[model samples]
Target: MLHLQVFTFNPFSENTYLIYNDNQECWIVDPGMINEQECQELFSFIESHQLQPQAIINTHAHIDHILGVDVVAQRYNIPFYLHELEMPVLNNAANTARMFGFEYAGVQTKPGFLSEQHLLRLGNDPVTVLLVPGHSPGSIAFYYEKGDWVISGDALFAGSIGRTDLLLGDHPTLIHSIKTQLLPLPAQTAVHSGHGPSTTIGQELNSNPFLN
Candidate 1:
């Protein structure tokens, strides 16, 4: 089994996931930590556990979700990974934050893109990349087949779904992503979301007001 740690960070309360394997090597998923304490906690955890961070993976490039991209990228000398389409969104994080009347620094648009051909594996687990657009043009989800788990970014949520009013978001596409990318997973598979508590694929299929 993979070792997982979650940190709810930033004013947006984005759930950043740290995934590591038995070798003590790991990857950062959508690290949006805003405050010093959050960053310190994350770094402290890595130092204490002796984890070598290999990569920075972004589910999408929303302003709230990519806040810590610079911190980790600069500190670890690792590249940030996102879909090609999210480059513009990431580049405009400052504007997004400004529009919301918030002051956020380190809004950069320089990160690598991840395609279906690219794969991220830790230990024996291989994370299959699924380009799940709709919540955002380049939103993607990572599925660990053997582990029976899916890390759903902002595409799907508990009792709800990601808002489509934002940039490049379409309600129809979001619905399609849910029906196709997420619903096909095994019913018992655990769904780890970008925010809120974790839920099962079966539970969301049956109970999520948006999905139903």
Candidate 2:
């Protein structure tokens, strides 16, 4: 079974996730730590569990979601994965943070772009990559079939959907992505988002205002 630990970090309260299995092999997603305390917290959890981080991934390159990508990737000496189309978004992260009155070092490491045609493997498990853009030009979500859960960056929230007012964001495209890519999943599948609380697919489908 896959195990997950969530650390709500940074001024943005972004949800960073560490996912691992019995093998102790793990992946870090959206490392949102921005200060010493937050970084130490994440490091402490990994060290305490003796987890071996295999990869670093970002569902999107928005400033709040990637504040600690550089630190985490460097510490684990792992490859950072993001969609190729998000390069522009990644490049603008620091500036965006500044506009928000937050200082971010920005992710300095080059990312290995996720491919729409491929499945990501962590040890023996397979993770499906969904190109659910519009929240950002290259926003994506990770779906684990066996676990029946999706790490949906800033896409679908508990009772809302990702905003389409940011750079390259489009309301229609975001809605379409959620409907066609996310809603099709099983009702019981858990939706793990980049911010706020977790919700099930069924709950969102039944009551999410934007979807309705």
Candidate 3:
């Protein structure tokens, strides 16, 4: 079975994830660590568990979600993966950080593109990539069917939904993407969001005001 570990990081309280299998091979998802302390916390866990990081896979390129991407990728000598369409968002990271009054040195990692056409693998486990935009134009989610969970980056939240006021954000598109790509999952499927606490699809389906 694949195991997931979540770390709440940065001023944004973004949830960073580590998905690993029994073999200790892991993938770091949306590393949001913004300071040395946060970065050390992430590294300490990996070292303590002897986890071997395979890659840095992101659901989108939002500034808060990628603060530590370069650091982790460089530390582990791993490649970074992001959706091809998110390049514009990634390119604008520094400006976005500045706008939010955060100090950022900008990301130097080159990303490999992810598409719905492909499945990401860690050992024998396969992860389905769901293209769900509107939070950012290239927003995506990672679904691990066997694990009955989806890592939804700033897409679907517990009681609310992703804010559609940012650059390229569209409320209508985000809602449609949620209904089409996320809501159809098994009602019991776990939803690991980018921010805030986690919730199940059934719970969101019943209580999420944005959906109703």
Candidate 4:
């Protein structure tokens, strides 16, 4: 079975995830560690668990979600992946950081692109890439069928949804994306969001104010 671990990091309290399998191989999702101390926290966990990080997979390229991408990717010598449409957002990271009063050296590594056409795999297990969009132009979610869960960037939340006032955000599109792409999942499927606590698809469907 695939195992999941979460770390709440940075001033945004973003949730960074480590998805690993029995083989000790893992994919680091949304590495948000912003400083030396935070970086060490992530490294220490990986070291303690002896996890072999294969790649850094992102749900989106918001500044807070990607602050540690460069550090973790370089340290592990692994490739980073994001949807092709988030390129502009990724490219604007430096400016976004500056606006948010955060120090950023900029992301030096290029990223591999993800799409609905492909599946991301760890060992023999496969993860379906769902193009959910709206929170950002290229927002996506990682659905692990075997694990019965999805890492939903900022698209959907427990009782609310992602704000559409940010760059490239559109409220109508976000609602449509959630209804068409995410809400159809099994009710019991767990939703691991980019921020705050985790919730289930059913919980959100029944109580999420935005959805209603």
Using lDDT, give the best candidate's number: 3
Candidate ranking under TM-score, highest first, comes to 3, 4, 2, 1
lDDT of each: 0.86, 0.91, 0.94, 0.92
lDDT of 2: 0.91
Estimate, for each residue in 1-212, the C-alpha lDDT of model 1 and write its tens digit: 67779989987889999989888989999998887999998999999999999999989989888888888999998888898988777777778888889877645536777895467777667888988889999899988877788889999887888989987789999999889989989999888898899888999989988877
Pairs that collide, model 3: none
- RMSD values for the candidates in order, in angstroms, are 1.4, 1.0, 0.8, 0.9
Candidate 4 lDDT, tens digit per residue, 65-170?
A: 9999999989999999999999988998888888988668667889999996478889989999999889899999999988899999999988889988878989
Task: Count clashing residue pairs in model 2.
Answer: 0
CA deviation > 4 Å runs, candidate 4: none
lDDT of candidate model 1 versus the reference: 0.86
Clash totals for all candidate models? 0, 0, 0, 0
Each candidate structure's TM-score, on Cα atoms with residue i matched to residue i, is 0.95, 0.97, 0.98, 0.98
lDDT of 2 at 61: 94
By lDDT, the candidates rank as 3, 4, 2, 1
Off by over 4 Å in 1: none
- The TM-score of candidate 2 is 0.97
- TM-score of model 3 vs. true structure: 0.98
Q: Output the lDDT of residue 22, model 3.
A: 99
